[model samples]
Target chain A: MTAKAAMRKQFTLNPAALEQLFSVLESHDFQIVGPTIRNGTIQYDYIKGCKELPSGWTSEQERASCRLKRRKDDALFGYVPGADSLKRFLHPPELRLFRAERENGVFRILDNPAPAPKLAFVGVRSCELRALSILDRVLAEDRYPDAAYVAARRRIFIVAVNCTEPAPTCFCTSMGGGPEAGGGFDLLLTEIVSDNQHVFVAEAGTSEGSGVLAVLNPGEVTKEIMAALHEAMDRSKAAFKREVATEGLRELLYESFDHPQWDRVAAQCFLCANCTMVCPTCFCVTVEDSTDVPVRRAERWRKWDSCFTQNFSYIHGGSVRLSPKSRYRQWLTHKMAAWVDQFGTFGCVGCGRCITWCPAGIDVTEQIAALRGTAAPAASDGAG
Target chain B: MNSDTGMKPKIAIFKFASCDGCQLSLLELEDSLLDLVNAVEIAYFPEASRRMLKGPYDIGLVEGSITTHHDAERIQRVRRESKTLVTIGACATAGGIQALRNWKDVGEFVRFVYAKPDFISTLKMSTPVAEHVPVDFELRGCPINKLHLVELIGAMLAGRKPNIPTYSVCMECKRRGNVCLAVSASLPCLGPVTQAGCGAICPAYHRACYGCFGPMENPNPTALAGRFEAQGHADRDIMRAFRMFNAWSWQFRQVSEERERR
Candidate 1:
């Protein structure tokens, strides 16, 4: 790497230069997966270029609610994180482990030969970046690592976007994650849009990122650019009025095992596994094996599982966490407390997916606060 | 009786009171049909074949609900004849849409709708096959997923547990990257309390899942009802949602009754 590429640098980019960034990735045969409008929500999908991005759309999120609305201006990264994150791409919902066939009564196993694709993930948020790091701790560095996850993580290039717009449900600030792109990205972008100009203040976090920017030859970051970046970030930071209160959270949750609050929450909890499925750091998986009777061929598949499912806790005779109360308690305690004991970091990055995607508006942050005795459980408004 | 049917396992398909859509799922297995035929001896299937063989069968795939007094008695004999009695479709598993009569007066309906009410021989309520006989397995869905039927047959032959997930439809929806209609569009969906089997077809096409597959393992329908209420769905509408294909399922039945009371 050149000396200039070795050192982290910042640059200013216009809409045209942003388009060039996509071209650079395309030139290297990277499949660009970014946020796009689908099913009345902004979700991640394969995109050809910035044209496919949800440019003029923004998401309105609340507890158990999300709706996409048209923005006055065409800002590419205007919305907060939706139902998807990098987890969908890195650790897919279903993956074939192996295929086995018996010939002459001798069984032979064949490893799934599907190669991981080179992926360029754009419009990644700060919480998502932390989520990836947290997932790496489980799926990559664990005693028994997931080979498929490792393979998928191998050829990924992240184009992280610093959040300037955080949803009402977002609590990244509480989980030690802020709107700013701290690290774990090749290139970082801070979108600054106004009536006059729509530009991105970009920075290289790696040599490869710098090399990509070198091709575009973006302008030097000016005073005006820094001011715009700071202004937008300040607005976002100020928006996070609520927090999880992580201080002594682990101990609090452990002590509150028999807390009546659990029953209250469970009363409205669907136990549908939506919270866990949408969770970025939830790496729990279950394996299924099926055989073709005629062909004498069998295959094993690993599928994403959730603690919310009764079958998830099944042990021989019956499931351990039988009640919805117990299941909800297990999920919250594990995410906030046990994850720290295991991974040295909390599981939740405060993405608020569990809140926004919950059929019942059972907010985790609110639950934590209620458990802490700082707030009373919201009176069951008769409608959850 | 096919006593000398060689080493191949004997399979029988029986129908009761249903739309025959579940049995059609078997015929819809265009490619797997040949493989299934080669793997098992289809001793009896009235829908597909005229050769009605008696049993002592290995696996009896029963479709539809026990709507008549005759069907209720017939299921007992079917259970005794088959080594493994597997109920297929919502009708046999949870009492199909026909079981909506369980909430109403069946006699009044027979009198009102039929010209010859005295001639009609019917039970007070439509009931699942499991109510009469101990079912070894119950393949769910209004028209059971063909892939699931194939998997069940394959597993029975292999002497292994079928890989049919009892988890909620939300699992499959998330796997398919379907934006939660309940959350995003405020559409009252039964996916949370419903079982996973249909590959989340309804949600994928931008409609709420109507719970055709029946209640999931440990379903929290009351909790889902609360959510629906929060979304401004009327109690009657919420009740009607559960009173669909698998309406007689106890989990869904209890919740629908609760809604009606309100």
Candidate 2:
């Protein structure tokens, strides 16, 4: 889809009037889940009014940087992503399948999938929107149809916001995913600051988006507004400080088994699994069951798993990947270059969550570059 | 013979040095778990069941490697107690990730990672159970392939040999019509040397095989490594690949050491 075709019937809302739009969105009977400063971080949650929004919020992230401070000026989407994207809400960490009930000599399992609420996720960044699309391919596709996720995803609305500022750890440009969302969202917003005006250029892609736009009674998208958005996206793209080349990356990465760089990184990796937890696309899971006090019945659940964990590779008599280096190799090689071969696309959204969230602060881009004779550059810190 | 006609085989799950991934694989079989439990007497699985029944177990599925001195002695007892002992993963068949210490001084590694080396008792190096006891069968994978695990258990139950591929991960990669990461992406893949069991999961997940399952029937480790170098990987990296999980296995050890020397 061309940028315009996916663009919603455009509308503009200045920063002063933005609160009215939030209230308008809240009043329209949709659950408004937007960004808020909770526990010293910008997290997505239900907001009752504009006061709940992180109005003057900004975040600082480095190789292992995480500090949130109020911005000197009001900028809604002026920060890097949190320890989360929208993955947790959409693809829950733990999913329970069905309940087993024994009746009349047969044990019947009832698959109790929750119906997704009419959720309006506000302030979603471009990469996050793309990450949702990857999740779309994994969960809602015709092949693996994750029934539980599909129900929640189908009737939802996405409010995508462009990134004017990029984190030092941010590298969405390399993976071809973000900074400016070209697709996946229902409505796209570009935060604009011109003199005294603080406005968001709004466009609707889906009909559900059209209905939401109509409620706000926002101005029609003008050619000037379109021009402004292009400028904004280009600025966002330029803001990217780190980039990974996805060019012949498949061959460049998948073919090289004897890369010296892996050991250097392996020496640093503790295999703590923080990277996978923060990653939006990783789907490794393990099942656990516990009886609810009454030992007669048991409830089983699937929990998030990371290949970095020692037990993840355990076979009957032993573990297959015996070393930290081996396990780390599997995870890195899979996410960056090999995911394309498996899923016909890159596994990473290039949000740099793995880098920033990693306690070790490993940069996948740096690791890949190292194999190609690129030395590890001096960084303020790293995320693993 | 008539009296034993209907008795189901008793199955016991065991663990070693590795993560609980192998046992978790069996547990992941949500729909089939109850049926599996119904078919076998789950005599013991310390990870799953607390009951430590004395075994002359019909089938013992051993999950890790002999990492500690106690584990070495324990495997001997298990060998005597079980009718069939199938080592589950890389750790059981070849000393696992912990085996990376096989190259370094054991005392140095022990003192480096642990707070007190004196309190810790370990073998000089990690080794697979097969080195200590006769193993009836061996299953390969980082985490044992749940599909293969189920089939193996079922085959034992029905008195037949389990159908497992003895070919390379390369074959499975081709069967799945996966774009050869090496041929297509020039990524450093270990498909040629790694065993076929993981079903090329890393490739399926958009990554190259890291040889989580060790050497296949006849792995051309040099050929794959040579291509990796051709694509710009250093000799240290090539050596590192073979020296990973299955470093002690003669097949992998020889190749990695040769590259290191060069």
Which candidate number has the best TM-score?
1
DockQ of 2: 0.03
Pairs of residues clashing in candidate 1: B91-B96
Which runs of model 2 end up more than 4 angstroms from their true locations?
A1-9, A20-29, A102-106, A220-232, A292-295, A377-384, B1-262
lDDT of 1 at A355: 84
| Clash number for each model | 1, 59
* DockQ, model 1, C-alpha based: 0.65
lDDT, each prediction: 0.88, 0.72
True contacts kept of each: 0.74, 0.00
Candidate 1 C-alpha RMSD relative to the actual structure:
3.0
State how far residue B127 of model 2 sits from its true place (Å).
26
Weakest lDDT window of 10 consecutive positions for candidate 1 chain A: A375-384
